[model samples]
Target: MAEVLGAVSSIVTLLDLAGKVIEYLKSASHADDDRSRLRDEISSSVAVLMMLKARLSPTSPHVTSLQTTKTLAAPGGPLEQYKSDLQTVASKIVPSVGTGRLKVTVDKLAWPFKTTEIKALIASLNRQKTLFNLALQDDHLSISLALQGSTDALGAKIDNVTNDLDNVKQGQKGMVHIANSTDWPELTVPVQTEAQALEEKRRIEEWLSPLNFWITQDDTLRRRHKDTGGWVFDALEFRTWIDSPGNMLWCPGVAGAGKTVIA
Candidate 1:
């Protein structure tokens, strides 16, 4: 539990740093689109982290249940994964601003142009930010489902144990009933908490409906669009450009040339 808590804390701290980097990028000229995307990604990431943190809080009912179970199950691995992903993103963003790196890179560049290194850094950050946000959401859902399963299993075990002890001594049946009545409420708290967490996850997904729609639309376009045989070379070139670390990909064409479809 301590390890899990520490990992969660580290994720929060790294996300704070990532936010600072995004805020810095937001101040740069002619990068409004990138800034807006970063802002949305950061907002979504923070919201997810807050929800996870609430579930893991010391006073949370979910924590009480975990303590009673004598194990931390679902969230432990996911928290570690999130920690790793955040570390990767921080590694990319932090060094970009360290001790004259940006200034030196900008100074060596030609006049009347923004720093290519900085542009590439922002592109990389945005790409990783999107991937991390998606992974975080996946982990969040997995943890919630695991908690729900654990809660259900614990509830069943309590029922079975209570029934077995009740059968062991008929004379103590009334004592068993009293004990169950006293303990059942506390035992059910975790189950209720897990249910609440699942519901909250649902609510958060609904809140991200617009972003979800955009993702879905982008994926559909990717799948449905294809270049003609005559454009095979162009398609290969476009793929290579996307794979390269160089930032921009400009494909200008006439109005009816199907540029959007190809892209």
Candidate 2:
């Protein structure tokens, strides 16, 4: 039992470190004019997180009941049942949690909640972009679909956005230069954008710059916390908190009850 408690303590320590890494990764690119810098920073963090995930993977089992019920399985939860199930899960992982699944899951996510939803969305978008690039070389993938998957108006708009990526592939075939110039604005036409705005925005948003999305979301989390009675932030309730600007330092999915979000 002593050994078990010790391991749990170690797991908690690693989680605290990982949380700091995420917070640092998210804030590393503190810039307004470029997004690629943010993406690059995030990518670095993601790499570290992946390594940590491999090192601290947790055990997550898929539990099923009433063999026939498998046909009706869906995500919109059976709330009370989910709460009860996770309570059981919490008990099972307390002392003997593995480094692969339980540890990763506990540290990286909020069970029964959409905590990592934004990260998942970003990852999915990146994967789709990669797959699209790969399809460029395939003979089977039709040009139209490969270039732009057919769908609705929003789909068409997204397809238009993909064109910039195609332009990048073409432009890369030429020469590269590390351009450095402060984005200046005239009091007259400020916010009207200029020659390098598109490229700058791309750099800041995609890979090597501080990202707008990350900053906005971090700020949002902060505002949400302030709105709640500072009680939402009692350190005693949390096992740990990273240096991040949000309430992310705690054991998220492990919380015993819902902390209401009231204005």
- In order, what lDDT does every prediction score? 0.46, 0.34
lDDT of 2 at 130: 38
- Per-structure clash totals for the candidates: 0, 24
What lDDT tens digits, residue by residue, belong to model 2 across residues 1-263?
33323333433443454344344334332232222332453344334323322322234121111211211122321112222322332333233347655443333332222325434534543443333222222111221232233325434554566576557544543322211122433222223234454665465435322224454334334434343555545655442454444665432331112221221
TM-score of candidate 2 versus the correct structure, residues matched by position: 0.17
Candidate 2 residue spans exceeding 4 A from truth: 1-229, 237-248, 253-263
> Residue 158 deviation, candidate 1, in Å?
34
TM-score for all models, in order of appearance:
0.32, 0.17
What is the alpha-carbon lDDT for the whole of candidate 1? 0.46
Candidate 1 versus truth, CA RMSD in Å, comes to 21.1
Looking at candidate 2, what is the lDDT of residue 148? 38
